[model samples]
Target chain A: MILEGKKRLWAEYQKEIPDDNYFYVRSCIRQNFFPASEPTFLRILRDELKKDIFETPFHTTCSGIGYHSDIVPMETTMTVVARQFALMTEAGYENYAASCITSFGLYSEIIETWKHFPEVLAKVRKHLKQATGREFEIPQSLVHASDIVFKLRNEIAAKAKFKLVNKHTGKPLKVVEHIGCHYSKMFPSKGVGGAEYPYVLVGMIEVWGGEVVDYPERRHCCGYGFRHYLVKANRGYSVANTKKKFDSMEPYKPDMIITNCPGCPYFLDRWQYVIAEMEGKTYGGDGQGIPALTYEEVAGLVLGYNPWDLGLQVHQIAVEPLLDKIGIGYDPEAKYKGPNGEDLGKPEMPMSIRCC
Target chain B: MGKLYDMLVEDVRFQEGMKSCMNCGTCTAICPAAEFYRYDPRQVIDTVQTKDEEAIEDLLKSETIWYCGECMSCVTRCPRKNAVGLVIVALRSLSQKLGYFVESEKGRQQLALKRTIGAWILEHGYCVYPRKITVENHPEAGTIWKWEQDNLDLIHKRLGSNLDGEGNGGLRRIPQESLDELQRIFDVTGGSDFYNQIEEASKKKAEEMGLSLDEYVKFVYTTNNGLHGRDEE
Candidate 1:
C-alpha cells in the first residue's frame, strides 16, 4: 500500500485501517457528469482486475466543498452526514470510500470529531436520531479510488490491452501526475500513501509504460480560489498559476498531465482553456484545453477499452492524440463502429453496484 | 481577540469562523483524504465551536490533523466564517505542543518542508539558493557557476529585495530578523523541541516500519510548495 501517502496514514494511525480490501465510495461529481468513471472502475473490479469487494449505497455527498463554499448550513450538513451514517449502518457497510477527494476529507473530519468529542458528536448524533430516527455509528472504514488502483497495480497491467501509440511530439509519453490534497490529507493514517504525494496514480502511469515526470509543484492544489476564480485570480491568475504548474512540468516535456480525482481533472482539464484564452495561444485543438486524463479514462484506453463506450467523446478538451497512440480512433461523437463494425454509443451511469 | 490556546477547536477564534460556517460539510466533503483517512476538519471545527478538549486532543494525534494541504476553499465559501482551515493549523500547533506528533516517515518530509526548505525562504528572500554576482573585472562574482546562468541578471538585478522594500512581501521576501522574531514566538508557542522530537521519530519510524524512502521522497520534494501561504495572501 505504498501509494505515496499511505505510509503517513499507517505511521499516524498505527493500522487503525489498512489493506487492499476497501468499501468503494462513489463521487457525486463523477456520478452526475463523469459517470463513465464509476463503471470504469467497477467493470475493472468485476471483469478485468477481479478483487474482493462489495458495494453499499448508504453514503451521500460529503458536501464538504459545497459547505465550505457557503452554500449549505452547518445543521443541514450535520443532518446529511448523520443520515448518511445511518444509511451505512443500516446497510451494514461501515467502510466508506469516495471517488471525490473533498468528500473523503469531510467524512474523515466528522468521524474522528464525533468519536472523540462526545458532546459535539452526541449533539449531531442526537439531532440525526431525532430527524432520521436511526442510530448511526459513522463509518470507521474509508478509502479513495487511487487507493484501490495502487493496491491492484499488477492486475491493471495484466489487463491493459491498448498501448499509447500517440505521444507528445512523437516522444515517449512523459506524464506529470498532480496528486490532490483532499484525497490524502484527511485520513493521514489510512491514506493511500501520505499527504502531498500518493504513489498509486504514479504507479498506474508507470505500469501503462509512460515515464513519470517529477516536478516540485506536483502536489500543489490547483489554486482552487473557488469564489475568486473569477474575481481574485480570475482567468489571469488561473492562467498564471496553471502556467506555474505547466512550467514545473514543462522541464520534463511531459506529453500529458494525469489525475484520478474528478475535481482535479476538472480544474486541470478545463483550466487549460482558460490559460489559453489568457495567453491568447491556441491549445492543440484550437480553444480545446491542454492534454490530460483521469486514471480510469487512461486505464480504459490502455486496456484497449472502447473510447465511445467510456465516454471519451464528451470531453471538453481533446485527447485524440492519446486515442491515436493507443490505436483507438478518435470519435468526436463516438458514433464510429469498432473494427468489428459494431456501433458503440455510451455507457450508462450506474445507479447502484448490483452484483449482476 | 481570544488567545488561541489548546488544540481543541473550542480554543480557536471561533467567532472568526463561526460567522461563516453554514456547516455544509463541503469543507469535509471536498477534502481529498477524508474518506480513506478518517479525517474531517469540518468535524474538528464543530468540536472547536464547542471546545471539546478530549476530542481535540485525540484528533491532534490522528494522522488527519497534519495532512491539510491548506487550499482554503473552507474559508472562501464559509458563510458562517468557520475557517476549518485555521482550526486545522491550531490542531497542528496543539498536536506539536502536546507531543502527540511523533516522527513518522512522512513527518520527516514535513520537517524538511518546514525547517530545511521553508527555513531558507523564511531566512532569505527566495526559495532557491542565493545567487552569486559576476561583475566583470571583479573576479569575486566572475564566472558564477550554475547561478541561474541564464537569468543571472534576473536573479540579482531585477528580483526585488525586502531590503529595498520592493519585494512581493512573500515569506521569502521578509527580512531575516523579522522571520527570526516569528520563529522565536513559534518556538515558544508551536514548540520547537516537540518539532525536533517528531522529526527524529519520523526517521526511526521510517526505518522501523521498512518504508520506501525514495518514491515517497519524490512525492515530498515535489509537493512542499509554500505551505505558509495556504490560508492568507
Candidate 2:
C-alpha cells in the first residue's frame, strides 16, 4: 500500500528470499483495477525482499472478475482460467497467490470444477495439448496474501523500523481487521488459520501492536457489487451494505481501520463518505467518503511508512484526522486537499482485493 | 438492451423481489451476502421503488455483488416475504448485459463462473446442488473438488419436497422424466442457452486457469473455489 496497492507485500525488506520457484500469477483485475497498491507491494517484494517473482502479461484477468456479475459464462471462465494456471505450474511455479480473495476462490473453483466435470478437464487438456504442446497440472498449494501476512506477522514485527504518528489528530490508532469473504469462503481449511475466526489481518494488526476492535458485523463486506451496482440498480442495497460496516465500526471508535483485501478497503473507507451523506453526519470525509485502508498500507504506515509512500494521500475520505488519532502522522502541510481546496477525497481508481 | 436481455430474462422465475420489502433490515441482519457484500436486501427493495439509478450504480462498484451466496436466507425471514437473492441475479444479469459488469475485481470473478456452471449443467443437467457427500469424504478425490456436486434428492428430502405418493398428489417424479420436464421448462424459460454457455466457457476457463478438469469432473463434490488464497506481493 505504501507504494500503491496489493502488488506484493513484505517483499521490499525481505533479504533471504525463496529461490526455488514461486507463482507470479495475479488477477488482471487487481493489477489494472487496483494498481496503486500493486506498485507498493511489488516494491516491497522486489526492492525490499530481493525475491525473484515474474509475471506473464498473457495471463488474462481471472474470469472471477465476472463470476459475481453473472456474465462471461462460467464454462469459458473455468476452462481458460484453469488452463492458464496449469500453464504456470507446468512452467515450474506451482505455488500461486492472488491480491483479490475472490480470485483465489475462483482459482480454487477451477480445480474443484475439473474434478467434478471430466468434460471440463478433458476440454482444457485437449486444448492445452493442442496449443501449448504441453500437459498441465494443478499445483497442490495456492493462497491469499493475507494468509501469509498473518503467518509471518511475528517475523514482520521484529523487522519493524518506523513508528507512525498521526498527521493531524495526533492520536495513536488502535485498529480492527476486516477480512474479505472470498478468503474465507473458498478454501476455509488451508487459506486462513481460522475461517470461523480468521486471524490473518486481525492477527497482523495485533502483531503491529495495534488494538483490534470487535464490531458487531466485523466480518461483513464492503458492499462491492459482483456487478456494478448501478447497472444492476442496486444502489440503496450497496449503500446500506457499505453503511453496515461504518455503523458497526463507528461505535468502537478505533483510531483507524485495517483490512487485507483491496475490495474490502473500498467499502471500509469510501463507503463511509457516502453513508455520512445519507445518514446526515457533519464529520463525513472531505467528499463525505469512508475509511480507506488495506492491510499492507496499514502495516506499512504503523511501521514508520509514509502515506505518500503508502499511497494514503489518494483516498477520497481524508485520513489526516485518522493519522492524527493513530499516531501515524503525515505532515499536516501536505494534507491532501480535494479540488475545492477541501480534502482530496478518495482516489477514483477501481480498487479490488486481487493482484494483477 | 444487451443480448442477455432475452438470454435469461424469460427464465427468471422469481416471484418475490426486494420491491416488496418494507425496510425491516431483517434480511440485512441475517444475509450472508450482506455480511460480506454489504448489500442490504431491504435497500435493494427501496432503491427499486425510488428509482435511484445513480446510487444503484455506485453499489455496482462495490464488492457486494460477490457477497450473495444465493442462500435465500432472507426469503421468508423478510417481513415482506421478498428474496433479494433472486434480485441479485437480476442485478447480475443487468450488469452482464451492460459492459459495466467489468467495474470491479469481483465483476471479473464472474467471467469464470459461466464455464464452471455451464459444464456442470451440460454434464449433470443442474447448476449446483445439496452439500453432503462431497470430496471431503473422499481424500483421494482432492478435497476442493469434492464440493462440486449438489444432492437435490437429499435436499428435497430435507425440505420435505419429496411427495412420496401420499403427500400433495404424490408429486414424486421419475428421474429422467423430471429432467426432461426441467429441460422443457428451461427452454421456455430461456435457461437452456444460459446453461449451454456455462459449459462451453467452463471448458476453456479450466484450461486457462490450470484447473484439473479431469479430477474435478469425476470428483463427487466440486463447486467450491478453494478459499483463503490471498497473495502478499
Candidate 3:
C-alpha cells in the first residue's frame, strides 16, 4: 500500500505543459553567471521544441534576494511580485515561469499568502494600483523553468541526439540532483514530489538515461543564504555549508551534478574551485571536482547544443571533463569566441585545478 | 505593556515561528549557521520564550539575530514545527525599525547591503547587474567577467540578449514607465521607508563616529569582526 501510494504521488508530480504561451521572467543570477542558459532555453522552446515563450525586460527582479537578506521587507517583496503579475496580466499570459528558483519560490509563497489571507492580496492590489495604475489577475499556473522541462522531459529525451551515459563503459552516468532549498523546503505541496523528495531534476536525469545518485546531505541548501553569501563576515557559513554537501556527495562519485536553482548551479560549481584552493582537496572521480550545471543547460547538452554557445566556459569548474566522459566532440581551442566568431582565447591562467 | 518582548510576541513572524518550545536542541543540531558561528537557534528561541524585555532588547542589538542564514532548516527539523528562522526575521525587522541594528558589527552591514542591493533594485531594476559587480569587489567572478565587461555589447549580442537596448527580449533596457512604476511600488509598500531607516540609522552612527555617511558605509562594507574572515585583497 505504501508503494502504491508512492506510485500515485509520482503520477501526480507531472503538471500540464504550458505550451500555448509562457511569460518567462529571467533570473538575476542565471543571467549574470551562465548568460547563455536563458538564450539556450529560448532556442530549445522556440526552435527545437516549438513552444511560445515570451521574455521581457519589463518584468523586474522579484526582490527575493534582498528580502531574504533582510534589507527588503516582506511587504516590499510581495508588492514587487504583484507588479510582475500585473505585467503578465498586461501581456495576457496566464502561465508564469520564472528562471530563478528563488523567484519561483517567492512567487509561490506570495500566492499562498494571498490564498490564505485575501486581505493581504487586496492590500497589495491597492498598493500596485496606486503605484503603477495597473491591476492584475492571478496566473492560472505558476512554475519554475525546471518544472516546465520536467513536464517535457520525455519529449526532450525522445529528440535527444545523445544519452547521459559513459561512452567507454557503456553505463549510465551517475548524476546527483540538487534541489534548491527554496524550491520545496518552504512549501512542499508546490514542488514536484514535495520537499523530502523533489523529483524536478531527477525526472530530467532519468528521462535522459542517467542514474540518480542519492547521497547524504542531498537536501542541504546551496549556501546562497542571502545574507550569508552577501556579508563578507558570514561567507564562511556559506562555504562550510557547501563543503558539507561536497563531503557527503564525493563518496558517490557522480559524473555530474544537476540543479534546479540558478544560484545552486553557480554556487555548487564555484565553491568546488574555492574548496580546492583553500583545502587542497578535490571531490570527483579523477581527483577533479564534480562539474555542476543547471537542468536547462544539461537538457541543452543532451540535445547536442554547442558547449561554448551555452556559456559553459564561464563555469569555474570546467564542463569539458563531463563532455569528454559523454563523448561530446568540440574544439577546446575555440571556447571563448566573440559574436563574430573571432577567438577571444581562453584565460591565460586557469583559476583552480587539482593541485595536491 | 508594549515592552520589547510584548512587541515581538505580537508580531506574526514570532507567532508563526514559536510554539510550545519543549526546550529541544533539534533546531541547533540541524542548523548550518550554528555549526559555523556562535549562533544557536535553540538558544535564540529559548531566550525569546523567556519573555524578558531586557533580553529581547539585547537580542535586537546583538550579533546573534544576524547570524541566522534563514535556510529554514530549523523550521523543518523542529518536532513542534517552530520556525526559529521566522523569529530571527522578526527580531531583525524590529532591530532595523528601532535603530538598534547599528549597535552591533553584523548589524552595521545592513547599510552596506542597503546601498548595494536595496538601491540597485530602485535604480537598475535588477539586483546584481553585471555593470554593478566591479572587478575589484568580485574577483571571484574570474577573468571572464572582466572580458565580458570590456566587450559587453558584443558578448550579449552573441548570447542573443539585447542587453541595454530598448525592446522585446534579452536584458533590454528597462523602459522608464516600468522603472517609474517600480519606484512607486517601493514608495507605497514602505520599501522607501525601510531604505530611509537604514540610511538614517547609519547616518547617526556615522555622526557619532566623526565620519561621513559615505565613509561609514565603506567601513562597514570593508571590515568584519575578526571572525569568519574573507579575502582581504
Best by TM-score: 3
i-RMS for every candidate: 22.6, 22.3, 1.7
lDDT of each: 0.51, 0.50, 0.82
Model 1 misses residue A201 by how many Å?
Answer: 0.9
In order, the candidates keep a fraction of the true contacts of 0.01, 0.05, 0.57
**Which digits, one per residue and each the tens of the lDDT, describe model 1 over residues B1-233?**
12333324353223234554545787776553342234576776666555455655556556555545456445544545466675665555545444455432223344334443334323442222233212221121112122223333232222221122333211123444434433442243332454465456555545655755444344443343333223423
lDDT of 1 by residue, A16-114 (tens): 334434566556445433446667777777677655455543333444543433222344445566655665676667666567766666676656655
Q: Write the per-residue lDDT of candidate 3 for residues A110-219, one digit (tens) a residue.
A: 79768867777898889888888889989999888888888888989989988999998999999999988878776677788877678888889988989999987888
What's the residue-level lDDT of A10 in candidate 3? 79
Query: Which lDDT value does model 1 have at A77?
Result: 48
TM-scores, one per candidate: 0.55, 0.56, 0.94
Give candidate 2's error at residue B218 in angstroms. Answer: 43
The DockQ of each candidate is 0.02, 0.04, 0.60
Which pairs clash in model 3? none
Query: In terms of docking quality, how is candidate 2 classified?
Result: incorrect
lDDT of each residue in A1-356, candidate 2, tens digit only: 36644435433322222332456554333332233455555545555555555554334345454445464344445544565576576567866656667677667656765675666578666654543444667865666665555555665676675433343444335576777766653345544543455667766766665667787877665665553331222334455676766667766665666766655665555455444444545223333333457776766665566665565644445566665555555665443332234443322322221000
In model 1, state the lDDT of residue A285: 34
